[model samples]
Target: MDTPLSVLFSSAEDEKYVLDCMAYFMILMAACTFVCLLFKDASYGRYSSSKYGFLVNAKLAWFVQELPAFLLPVCLLIWASSAKSSLLANQLLIAMYMCHYTQRSLIYPFLIRGGKPTPFLPFFLAVVFCTYNGYMQIRYLSHYADYPADWVTNPCFIAALSWFVAGSALWLLGWLINLHSDHILRNLRGPGESGYKIPRGGMFEYVSAANYFGEITEWAGFAVAGQSVHSAAFAIFTAVVLSSRAFSHHKWYLAKFEDYPKTRKALIPFLV
Candidate 1:
């Protein structure tokens, strides 16, 4: 009996080719997303509209859509033949990928307070991206990634693995910033109060989308640490989407409040 993986990739070379194609596809998707967002705001959260057809509960949608990214890697490692998973370099890369998804899938959604429902189309599209990306990143790391035994220690591989050691600090800092920014946003409303309020302190003082900045930084650092085309593509995709979202958020904040700060940028500090 042929398994799905076997059917999709007959040999290791085939798998590598497919993964390369997928990374390029992600880059293309990122470009298309940026172009599309320029014309219309994505229908979710403050931008949610009825004409999008159906809406899914925000928490449910978040968890369900994000779950695949968390689960698929585990599935690939356990059931699929992943040769490099035991290697130190691959293990570290997989660990970094898992850490982000674990927080995203398990911890983030349930913490929501009066969050807006997601449009069905957006929710569905998110699921597709998660499923697609999860497979691409993990499959390559676990199965196709080939690094030398001293990749992490050798000066020659510093371009790839040394960055993993160096970028780990940046990744950790971004993760902490992301966590703190989310905490600030969640606590913005009082116990009984409703609706959005201007987030203060943390990254909020400098930018409207502090959370967005943190996540983008997180992935940019992840790309450096990962030193793979797939990770780089993902980081690009994250910046394009989140930066656009942040700009929308900045526009909304400026339009809604007469007292909004004039010096604050959208996604970046001091400059957009």
Candidate 2:
């Protein structure tokens, strides 16, 4: 029979195995997104060229796709026991993640105005990603991660705390920018008016894809705050995917409008 120590060691090995799998999965996901970008932009927004196999309402798609990330993490936190340590820091980190997804899945989707239909393939991919990512993040934080009891007083924690606060501010700023930019795009047409227009005001005045920039900023902040492999993986994935998306949108705008703003960058403020 396995002793208690053997069982503990086995559990640690299992956690390590799961983490390794998640890392590999993230790498593969990033590779696939990069390879696909070389051929065609994502099949959403102005880039939807060929018809997809299936379609769903954009609002419903967003809610359903993002729900797993929020709900799964919460479920994990509720059920998993911390790894023989006080999990104050981990709980805080989880809260921050939950805050973003709560707004995204439960609230923001419902507030969308005149959203375009989303394809089932991308929607389903998002669902899988959310489940995978959510479980990885929450599982690590809730059960595997541990900090020293005096970590708050440690120099490293102090530094990380600064980053956490700064990241939180950046996240809030990005959220505001994204929300306002989307609002601008949604209001571009009203009551039978159809077609895209050059978005102006706010960050849209500077960058073609202000919303993408905001989301990138938000994730960067998240990485800084969490300071974990999982968070860094997520941030890198966001940057890779959204940067390509922004480039595509920028190119589309330039092609569509002869008088497109020459000064506007693709994803950055001035230089991209």
Candidate 3:
């Protein structure tokens, strides 16, 4: 049997490279954390006075947290590919990274129909966590893992490719649903809105937090394609964190909107 990739790190150069990558990764993460804090402060105001105990807009908070987390993997893929000259893995990883960022960059800002930026505390926490995980991921990928030279030609590779394709399709579908829902709701409210209300139609018909659900699915599919513990962990973390947020939103919706959709589930469809 092939030895697990984790047991493959045997060289001093590999170890040193991993350490260097980790140190740089940490610095980058710190910068992202600082930026997030600044955005949080500027966008949401001070954390103490906010209703949700932070200054971020509720709808945008999930992306704010996810953005840095998304960056770490991309950075890792870039560094690993450059250092190791592994064209196939590097390209695949880059594609995965770009797929996520493309959606984030193109779709996220517009999704904020209207709300303050995320609160400083949650934003800060997300940055820190993402940075930490990013560092860990780069460090590990640099030394401890290996993939097939003909990874793209392999059957498993094809399956992973399919997973990626499916995931991407789902992500796009979710994005459109999220966008439409936000559009409808935004037009309905017509700016200067506050407080939670029942978001209807689109994916919201099936899940109360359709946008969050889309985001979670997108990351989860990315992880499935990459097939890395780091990626999987990030996906799982995204799911758990977003699920909690969805639940919070669900509860808030029910409390605030008397006629909220009783049929919709929180994070999942047809299940909790």
Candidate 4:
């Protein structure tokens, strides 16, 4: 259990109840965010607007906002009860979580070029989300989550997949897709140019929101591997949030590009 909230939960059951409540809270917030975004786009990136408070440097915003997700899990592991933190499965799960955030918070920000400043309110909200989700994920894994002994090594099928190997595989695939998609977007503009251009190659050939698709795949995989309500909620929340952003991007492209592929969809390839 997280030491700061030790007083709030007297027993394992109490801790679970608190976690469940937090998950529910996230879902409620998701609902509200979805409705709000329907009326107006989020105030960041290309949608950056002065209405959402002063802007912050995009790289700085991303780094600071995403840092908590990486930092808190480490703290959770260090402070966790030895019985929970010592499990190989738990360590692997945490590693999977860190793999994404480390790239987002540390690596991705620096790779950005000529990115617009992010509005302050959105940055603050991102920080809160990272902290909330970081605690929900790592705390559960470190102190509450359990797994079957054979989950990691079960060989009942396909030489190695009676376990949850499929989920891990999906996570890795999604990570690679995300990297590739980002690369495509970054190279869309030539040196000294300052306007948006149609992203080509890779999955962008199919969908306007290829990067969003990649990220959604990632957390969906995490949810599958973790097999916990917390993971599921996170996955669902991610889908709601990103799908809306994807819709916005798709809408923007249609408006901005007169020759935008009429056949190309928003987030999904054909169905969306």
Candidate with the greatest TM-score versus the true structure: 1
TM-scores for every predicted model: 0.95, 0.87, 0.64, 0.92
Mark the regions of model 2 whose C-alpha exceeds 4 Å error after superposition.
Answer: 1-10, 83-86, 150-156
Task: Put down candidate 1 lDDT per residue, 1-272, tens digits, no spaces.
Answer: 22277676677788789899999999999999999999998899988876785989989999999999999877887787655777888888888889999999999999998888998899999999999999999988887777876788788875776678777777777888899999999999988999778889999999999998999998888888887899999999999999999999999999998989999999889888
Q: What's the lDDT for candidate 3?
A: 0.60
Q: Model 4 over residues 1-272: C-alpha lDDT tens digits?
A: 34666677788888877888888888888898889988988889998987889999988998999999998877777766647666766777888898999999889999898899998999999999999999988888877887644546655534334335667787788788889999999888888988999888888888899999998988888888777888888988998999999998998999999999988889888889
Candidate 2 per-residue lDDT over residues 10-126, each given as its tens digit: 576686677767966796788888888888777865554337647778889889999999998766666555553255566666776788899888998887776678877777788
| Global fold similarity of model 3 (TM-score) | 0.64
Task: Choose 2 or 4, whichever is better by TM-score.
Answer: 4
Compared with the true structure, all predictions reach lDDT values of 0.88, 0.78, 0.60, 0.84
Query: What TM-score should be assigned to candidate 2?
Result: 0.87
| True-structure RMSD for candidate 2 | 4.0
- Compared with the true structure, the alpha-carbon lDDT of candidate 2 equals 0.78
Best by lDDT: 1
Residue pairs with backbone atoms closer than 3 Å in model 3 (clashes): 55-118, 55-119, 56-117, 56-118, 56-119, 57-117
- Please give the distance, in angstroms, between residue 129's alpha carbon in candidate 3 and its true position after superposition: 2.7
Model 3, runs deviating above 4 Å: 1-86, 102-107, 134-145, 155-188, 191-195
Q: Give the TM-score of candidate 4.
A: 0.92
Ranking by TM-score: 1, 4, 2, 3
